[model samples]
Target: MLLSVNNITIAFKSKKVVENLSFSVDRGQSLGIVGESGSGKSATALAIMGLLPPTGRVTEGTIELDGTDLLTLLRNQENYRGRKIGMIFQEPMSSLNPLFTCGYQIKETVLQHQAVTARQAEAQLTSLLEEVQLTRQLGERYPHQLSGGQLQRMMIAIALAGNPDLLIADEPTTALDVTVQAAILELLNKLRRSRNMALIFISHDLSVVRQVSDHLVVMYRGRCVESSSVAEVFSHPRHPYTRGLLACRPRPHLRLLYLPTVKDYMEERPDGTIVEKMPDNPLLGATRGSYSPSQFDPLLKVENLTVSYQNQINVLHSVSFEVFPGETLGIVGESGSGKTTIARTIVGLLPLKSGKIYFQNYLLGKARPRSVTRQIQMIFQDPQGSLNPRMTIGEALMEPLHIHRLYSSRSERRQAVIDLLTKVGLEPDILSFYPYAFSGGQKQRISIARALIVRPSLVIADEAVSALDVSVQAQVLNLLKSLQQQFNLTYLFISHDLAVVKFMSDRILVMYRGKIEEQGIADQIYQQPQSEYTKQLIQSIPQYV
Candidate 1:
């Protein structure tokens, strides 16, 4: 075996995070670890790589590589980690040093592990970048200067610098578009095959795991409840959690009135067993529309929109779209395809170079009225970054109310915040808790509640559910749908995940290089794509089964 984890127990302050986890991978083989957030998937990876946090410790078990125990090597400073077991972290930005060039980092790794001179290290760096399909010119740029895909490729280059036998990737493609994710997965598979490197891929996307993995482990909390070949597991998931994950995926083919969630698939108890129930979503039928683009009365309209940055890069060009009242207009595209730029422009964050925006038949100027701004709320991609860490959830939700001067009294505002929390399926007491204390799903719900505090008519969800687990994504989506119906809210939903877009959108718009490649009803766009770009995007979506 290239790597073996035997009865490993990872803990923080004596609290077990991953207990008795065991898995093995041979050369050229891939093992996938999947579960929801807080399921200890990353913790197990960190334990294997000897990169756990300060308080975290392996209380039991042995991780062996080629008859050598890695724990002993860590104490000896033998450089076993980077040389023998390369790690690709969940977030490339944090894994990489922002100050150093990508090439410098790769070269440094090579020099540290191998007995290579400066010239040899430079040569190795060039070859490694080439292997990862990153150009030599891009190698000179800093981490922040590169796109998400480019940065991830750079991470791969660094991981391959030492020519390790085993590579571990943790949620490597979570933030990427489907096309970029496909390319990255293909590159990893190719490299693993050519170099005969064992791999451990951890992710919440079961479809992605099925593509890259030979064997699979389904984790719940800290326990590995199920293990088998990828084909066996996908065909017949024995564990309820595993079954839930597989069942909860938002299919691009059909617009399900209610998404089957983890809660729906499991019985609530000490140990959740298999069960079935439709989640409560009264707003779904109420908000649903069967109208065409021409039929929808424009609640918010954008015409001849063109935007540019200081570098003279045209992020958006002649883009036009209309979002009807009580409907979701989903925008799907790659990282630099102007999806976010469009949202920012609508929210009055970015300078409108040349365009006309109207809301409720009123023309919005560069300096939009406070009333106009209040009516249009935006939910950002990063829920963690969007909410203030210093403030409690209550304060965060109350800020919008205060800004708009809605309620006259503090008690009334507090009650309003509680009501908002209730609407989003959160406890009223949770308002006193900080944002960091909540999970990704909870934080996003908090963000949704914050957006709703102002009673906005139009809500711009910019990749809102991109950074979440499949089941959690379903919950947030259902909540959004329900809220849309109850409040009659118009959603300008933007995301890179076409599957997610298909589920949430009333109409779909495909963007490429700041231009709309295709626009139609969600069903038509997904089922019968006209544009080559749209087809490619759809084809790139990973298939688990």
Candidate 2:
């Protein structure tokens, strides 16, 4: 075995996070660690690399690289950190230095491990970028200048600078477009074979893990619930959590009226024994959206909408679309496809150069009225950035009410906030906690509550559930559907995920390079796409084997 971890226990400040975990990987083999957030997958990677924080440590067990104890190397300070093992972090934007160019950063890494001069390091840097299917010209740009896929490629180049035998990738393809994600996976597998490198791939998305992994390890809360070959686990899941993960993803074949969550399958008793139950009937009364645009007048109309950046570069060009009442319009494309710009334009965040926007048949000028503003609200991609860290949940939810002057008294507004919290599956007592205290899924729920508190007519959800785990994503999607039915809401949903967009939208709009490629009924578009761009997007979606 190239790497072996036996009976390992990891802890932070004397509190155990990963207990009795064990796994192994051979040369030219890949082991996938599948779990949600806080499942201890990343912690195990850190322990193997000897990169744990000061408060964290390996409390017991052994980590061996080719039969050499890793813990002993750490104590001796002669470790094989960059020389024999490399790691690609989850978020490249945070891991890379913004002040330096990509080429400079990678060159530095190459120089650290190799006894090469500056000129020789430059040659190696060029070769690394080429190996990852990136251009050398892109190397001179800063991290922000590169797209999501390009940045990930740059990170791979840096990790390969050491020419290590093992690579640990933590959620490497999360939140990327489907095509970009597929390309990155292919690149990783290619590099692994060319170099005979062992890999530890970590992710919350099971479909993604299925594409690259040889063996699978399913984790929940800090324990490995199931371990087996990838095909065996998918064919017959022994653990309830594993079954839940497999059944929760949005399938491209059809739409489920209500997606099943993990809690619907099992429950843990007070004594720590698990009780299994039959999964909820996800296909009961499963139906597709039947809204007809010809019946009702358009709720929102955009004609010749165009938006430009501060540098006078147009990101959106002559875009036009209409959203009918009580229907969802899904917009999908890759990065730089103006999917987000259209959402910002509808919500009055950007100024149009020459176009007309009519909400409720009222023309929206450069300066929108308060009535128009209250009727249109937006949910951003990153819930953590959208919320205020210092404000309590109660205060954050009530601020919109205060601005709109909806309720008569402060007490009435407080009650309204509590009611909204309950609707979103959160307790009233959590109002006292700050945003940082909640998990990613919980924070997204809070964001949803804050958006719906004002009772808006149109809700623009922009990549809202892309960052969530499959099970949490199912819960949130179901919640959104329920809320839509109860409130008679209209959603202008935007996502790069084709399957998700298919599930949520009545009509689909394909956007490519700031232009609308095609728009039609959701089912028709998915079954027989007219445009090559739409077909390509659908083909890029990862399929389970």
Candidate 3:
């Protein structure tokens, strides 16, 4: 085996995150770790890379690279990191230093382990960029100047600078669009084949992992629930969790029933004990409560909206849509297709170059007061970036309320924060915790709570659930559905995940290059797409049996 993890256990403080998880990857082979959010996939990779935070430690286990125990190595071990192992993280924006040029960053990694002058390092950096399928000129660009896919490729170049035998990529393609994701996966596959390097690809999408991984390990609650060859596992999944995950992915020509998650059937007893019951499938439930088109009026209406950046090209062009109360309008497109720009324009973060926005028949485009901003709330794509890391969850939640002056009394404000947490399926005690302390899923839940604190008439979720796992995504989607029903709230749900959009959206709008290529009922669009872009998007979605 090129890399082997035997009986490994990792812990954060006193809580175990990965317990006795054993896996091995042969030379030139790919192994995948699949699981839901907080399932220890990334934690396991961190432990293997000797990059765990101070609070997290490898409690027990042997991480061996070709029979050399990596866990026993000291930080100063000369050949451990650069020569034997390399890692690529999930978010390129966070992983790359904003202050450095791409070439400098790559050169730094190469020079850290080798004796090389600046001139030689520059030459090596150019070759590294070429190896990662990027043009040499791009090396001079700052991280922010590069697109998401280009940034990810730069990260790969940095990871490979040392020519490590093993590469650990943790959700490397999660933030990319479908076409970009396929390209990255293809790049990784080609690199692995050519270099004979072992790869540990960690992600929640089974279909994606299956395409690149030869072997698969299904993880849940820090345990290896199932392990098999990708073909065998996908064909006949043994564990319930694995089956549920596979079933959750949107499949072409297959109508997916909403699969039950571990949380749905399990509830706390009156005495604070947990018990499991037969799971209730929400999608299979009676259609008796189906939404009617006439129940509520349009909460938000946009007509011929157009927006452009400062002294730049137009990003959104003549877009028009209405979000009715208690309805979800899904905007689907690739990255930089103006999906987010549209959301930002509607929420008043960006000025309309040309257009009209109406909320409750009031012209929002002309409104200048802060009161108009209170009725429209937006949840960003990256929860961590959107949230203030310095503030605790309670403080973050309370800031919106304070700004809007929703509550005057301290007691009432405290109660409101607690209620918001409960509404989002988080414990009230978590209110005192900071954003950095929470997992990706928890941070997103906090983001949702913050958006709902002011009780806005319309909420724009901009790729809100894309960072989450399948199970957590389902729960959050169901929560949004229930919340909309209870509060009569309208949602402008934006995402790249068609399955998620299909599950939550009443109407779907497909956009390409800042234009709405197609718009219709969600079911109709998915079942019979007319536009070529929509057809390609539907076809590109990963399929599962």
Best by lDDT: 2
- Clash pairs, model 2 backbone: none
- Superposed model 2: Cα runs more than 4 Å off: 75-78, 281-285, 289-291
What is each predicted model's overall lDDT from 0 to 1? 0.88, 0.91, 0.84
Model 1, span 268-364: residue lDDT tens: 5655443544545453323234545546669998999999998487889999988887778999999899999999988888888888888988988
| Residue 142, candidate 3: C-alpha displacement in angstroms | 2.0
Best prediction by TM-score = 2
Report the number of backbone clashes for model 3: 0
Determine the C-alpha RMSD for candidate 1 after optimal superposition of all C-alphas.
Answer: 2.5
**lDDT score, candidate 1:** 0.88
**Where does candidate 3 clash, by residue pair?**
none
- Whichever of 1 and 3 has more TM-score, that candidate is 1
TM-score per prediction, in order, is 0.95, 0.97, 0.86
Report the error of model 1 at residue 447, Å. Answer: 0.8
Better of 2 and 3 by lDDT: 2
Worst 10 residues of 1 by lDDT: 280-289
The order by descending lDDT is 2, 1, 3
C-alpha positional error of residue 407 in candidate 3 after TM-score superposition, expressed in Å: 7.0
**Rank by TM-score (best first):** 2, 1, 3
Task: Give candidate 3 misplaced runs (Cα > 4 Å).
Answer: 11-15, 53-59, 72-76, 107-127, 250-259, 264-298, 366-373, 384-421, 427-438
